[model samples]
Target: MATDRLGLYVHIPYCVRKCNYCDFCSLPNGGAQVPEAYVDRIIDEILSYSGRVSTPVDTVYFGGGTPSLLSSTQMARIVYTIRKSLNISPHSEWTLEVNPGTLTKEKVDAFFNLGFNRVSLGLQSIHENEMKTLGRIHTFDEFISSYNMLRDAGFGNISVDLMYGIPHQTLASFKKTLDTVISLSPEHISVYGLIVEEGTPFYQWRESLPLPTLDEECDMYELAGRQLAVAGYEHYEISNYARDSYRSRHNSLYWRFGEYIGVGAAAHSFFAGQRYFNTDNVDDYIASSGISVTQTPESECDLEYEYAMLGLRLKEGISLSDYESLFGHSFIDGKEQIISRLEEAGLLTLDGDRLALTEHGFYLSNSILVEIL
Candidate 1:
């Protein structure tokens, strides 16, 4: 097995109902039902990469339009196929994204038995009205029930998804959601502000919605960070907070610029200084002769800018040593003026050997990063 770490991401592009705010490549639950034949095609794709990428995989994440929709037998088959075909590490953190409406006791046990140690539940909000407004099938009670079931099913390393900045979301409502989440005390929490994508229904009606102001959104983010921190969760990455030893190792790989292979429809991967993505259409993905790797158009300058933008999202920020090792040059020499300006504005901090963003900086992080890049 190679010493270099790798990650495997499997995208299941099926959802019961398309959320208004979502634009990820996913089909309506009933429109494109996931058949066993589809699963076999994905397994074939996984096998194709066995000899191509020789590194040992440290993480395997089943992200989706609800990976929980798959039956235990189906999930076990996928996990088993990967284990047989790849050099999967014994202690790899295998995670599956589950929706509140889809989880069951049997499915949870099967996932645990098949070596899925981490579960990310899509409990977007604990408010029933908000859930309905967001077109979520699961009610608040159902989410709580699913959560309790996961706990009862012996899952300790769990992460819950929460959304802020909805159409009518007030600070008080957001705070209540945060308080409810804190009380549950999952090992990890991913708090995301709503982003209305171009093709989504939310975007069509965005102008009519009473969206939170930019400042209010920032306040909500900072407040959530402070509250989660107070509850013993470390605000490790942007939108991610975790208790000690429970950070999302798989996602951290993306921000840290580690290599990973993405399998299934619309999945993206970065490896060997190159980035590529599979075709987004499910039919196209299943019909393709084999694994298709489309090389992305990116320049060295583009990569550098991306590195800084992504790395800065972490609370620990970017390290000079790692930056130099990867790029074969010193960050200080090329970006002195830009860094100085950001630091002077109090948006960034330059410690001994690391550069990190301030809490205030995170709100305007994208703009600040663009300026620096």
Candidate 2:
């Protein structure tokens, strides 16, 4: 049986520059600010969790504002500490996120030598103008260079991120982006539709710009999915497409409602039937003597809703059997009427024991899920 193991996430909150559409917890580059002290604090936090839980870690992910910005030595030190502090399995998937400009051959080699088996590169688009519009500092040439360097470094498992529906992006431009991405043939590709979050530069500029309509965005999504499928990528999630054997193990943990522990500023964790987040302030996080009390765990109702939302995002949807196993009741007992209604509308399909969304339903998944849940 596959054990109900926990994954580990470490957030690196420093970035050389903040993107126009980003609202993630990150700080822009100031002066010479090294993450050494912050790494020490996180090591302490990990040690605090020792002996409190017995589950072995199967995955470790280093996500960030730009984790590649850290010196290779710094990264190695953090990885060493994590290995020492946790009961991590030898074959666990260890992933690190890298921005295009910061990935160098030396850095890539160092990360590989330190046992990072996966590297997720941020290559938002291949168009220089589009990159500029998104406030990205790297150009297409720089991204390609970084990619080649990683390949030269002998890293086999690589993932790349792309964005669609940006300002001035048309079907043709989006298709070109997809073509560029497919040509690279990454093991995994995460395509996201740009959402204008409040307080971000894109959101503030929304009034002056003509954003893509919802229908146009949906059309773009469908086109991308079709193209990716033709290239032998599985549309495993709403926004993720991966080649066989390349699906992100760490992200799958989130979609499957598995437990994970997150470290660093603004990191979130779900463990022991509880969900919580760390402080977003880097200075405060590093200054704390112990696990900061700023974390807030979720209520039981919130967890239920999260399970429904996350599971619905996957192509497999949620298993009725798994729902009963977790909640101690048949999923259909309470939602039979709703399921039947949705089935009538051709939004959901029930093939004996399995339940999933139909092709049309996936595009309107949110509305369908709200009705069912």
Candidate 3:
């Protein structure tokens, strides 16, 4: 019998150059070539999970610093190892996160042949000044070149990554970026408002930065939804929009509270009522016999809270039956008063067994979820 479906997240924590706003587990190329043993080590890690993990793979996401740093032969070897060692479903959706100036026709063709059906390109903005302020390595011209090459390489499913609220960004610039992306008609679009976190250059200079005013930021975000909807894209998730069935299956698994296996540095996984993440130290992960993993304790309340928080991210919201089945209790019974209040305030909607936020509630989701969940 076939095993249950599982999502697999593979982390490639290497970037040609780290962006100013980035805090992901990755580092600059540092003028050194990629480690020769990188392929073997990752393959070894994959094989180590063989008998330990019982589920078959439904979706595989190669997220990064920049997975495009891997050469075609290296990617092929790693992919081949995954197929050889795991029970990958025939209908699996494999996605690779790439950046501009790092991909070419041959590299993407290799990925296409290896069964990678989706590509999420990092295109933060189309304006040159914004790109420079964000410390991105490539220009809009470079993104165009990379994008065209991927299309030529027969990639039908592509997701563009965009950002707003960058220093000196304006609503007009955001529109140009949005309109340009819409013109390309990619399968998906992910737009995030910039957040300056600690330990980053942006954080240090945040006070003096000419970042968007709170009101302007809100307008930019609101405008994103309106423009994207006009372009025939479904605002499926808070930060994501898709056309037809091109929604990201791997990401959907997370929002649904489904199980997944994460391999590589700083990769987090939740499966079988437990949560864990591998060490963030790349050198340590490479040299150790066994990776140091941290198991986070999740109490019953924590799980329920997490479910509600994550489910609220989707436009479809949470299903009553599904919630009850997972937690063995009625979600409505637990939060009827709060639901009634939110509904009265026009921030929430109840469609039979489903509970989701309204279009207005989308921008206020963080506050609403904090209150309800």
Candidate 4:
């Protein structure tokens, strides 16, 4: 079943407004309306891979630009097209990424009515000044209102996104944001550290921004682990925390090196041992029917390294048996010395058949992964 299952990701490339720190492929809304024909193009792309998908899709994620920007009717049309064109499992985990101020009661109801089971809300920060600096259109109040609206619309699985290391974000302020989010008891929480990516407004002003000190940023990450643990949320991945069994299954597919199809402008796909992404240009994507992107074939070595890198991001890490069975090579080969060294430093844990990172190791994951890879 694991080998035959499929995951679907649909990218909605339009946003109500773009954030200052974002470098993701997205366009801000002007006076122009969202292209209704874009859904048709996405459907066309899905059917292009018709021969490869032998089993029903297990998950569907409507990632954004702001999927919430679509009207209920528009979203429903796309959802309907996906099911009509593909073999979707009856128990599929369908999720949409929504921004706070963009959600409407009608859209929320449409999502629930259409069988979308999860909503990942973008509530970057609750602090007013921080929100403005980040160029987010929604306020803390708006986030709360949108959240309540989702609940009323019958979304039991919701994830709240929070940011740390924000400009002028003090420890006290970050703690308060976390506390507020925890009080609401959303099914999942995604805590991320701020980064000034190139081509963004924050990058140009990075030198002058009053961002937290390196020490302070580290402190915030550590604090998040401690606080979330006390609140009964599992630190399942480096940037993700979930309560009970609410871990993101679609995302888990990615970490497990499972195959998936991504459709839309700037979307990426990994299937049948190849990886490719659609063109970043919206016009090109639409005109070309989403086939203008380059596809790269992966070598056996590249896949092995990818599995190690991605698997190490999880709390359970890599299963030695799975690695050997899949690749016909032991993951411990030649890397035992480095792994043993990391274990001695308390950055990694060798628990019988799995090689996982300790909590401290997760914080230094980038460096550790580089060393191993």
Best by lDDT: 4
Q: Against the true structure, what is each candidate's TM-score?
A: 0.96, 0.94, 0.96, 0.96
lDDT-superior candidate, 3 or 4: 4
Off by over 4 Å in 2: 1-3, 30-33, 294-297
For residues 1-373, what per-residue lDDT tens digits would candidate 1 score against the true structure? 1129999999998888898888998888753346777688889899888777778899999998878888888898899889988899879999989888787788888888899889998877777777777888888888889889888888889999998888778789999999998898899999998888899988898889778898888889989988998899998887899998999999998888788989999999887768899999898888875677688999887787778788999998999887787788887787788888889988899998899988778878878876776
For residues 1-373, what per-residue lDDT tens digits would candidate 4 score against the true structure? Answer: 1467889999989887888999998999851457877767877787676665777799999997888888877877788778877889989999999888887687788789999999999987889999999999889999999999999989999999999999999999999999999999999999998989999999999999999998998899989999999999999999999999999999999999998889999999886667898988888888885355688776888889999899999999999999999999788889889999999999999999999999999988999999988
Candidate 3 has a TM-score of 0.96
Model 1 regions more than 4 Å off: 1-3, 31-33
Candidate of highest TM-score? 4
Considering lDDT, where higher is better, how would the candidates rank from best to worst? Answer: 4, 3, 1, 2
Clashes of each: 0, 0, 0, 0
| Per-residue lDDT of model 2, residues 222-251, tens digit only | 888899999999999888999998899999
The 0-to-1 C-alpha lDDT of every candidate, in the order given, reads 0.86, 0.84, 0.87, 0.89
Candidate 3: tens digits of C-alpha lDDT, residues 1-373: 1227899999988888878899999979842445756556677778887777767789999998888888888888889888987888889999999889887787788989989999999999999999999999899999999999888988899999999899989999898999999999999999998989899999989889999997888898889899999988899988999999999999999998888888888889886667899888888878754435789987888988888889988999999898888889988887788989999999899999999998778878989998887
Which stretch of 10 consecutive residues in model 1 shows the poorest summed lDDT? 29-38
- Structure candidate 4, residue pairs in collision: none
RMSD of 1: 1.9
Candidate 3 residues lying further than 4 Å off, grouped into runs, are 1-3, 30-32
Report the Cα RMSD per candidate. Answer: 1.9, 2.0, 1.9, 1.6
What is the total number of backbone clashes in candidate 4? 0
User: What lDDT score is found at residue 275 in candidate 2?
Assistant: 66
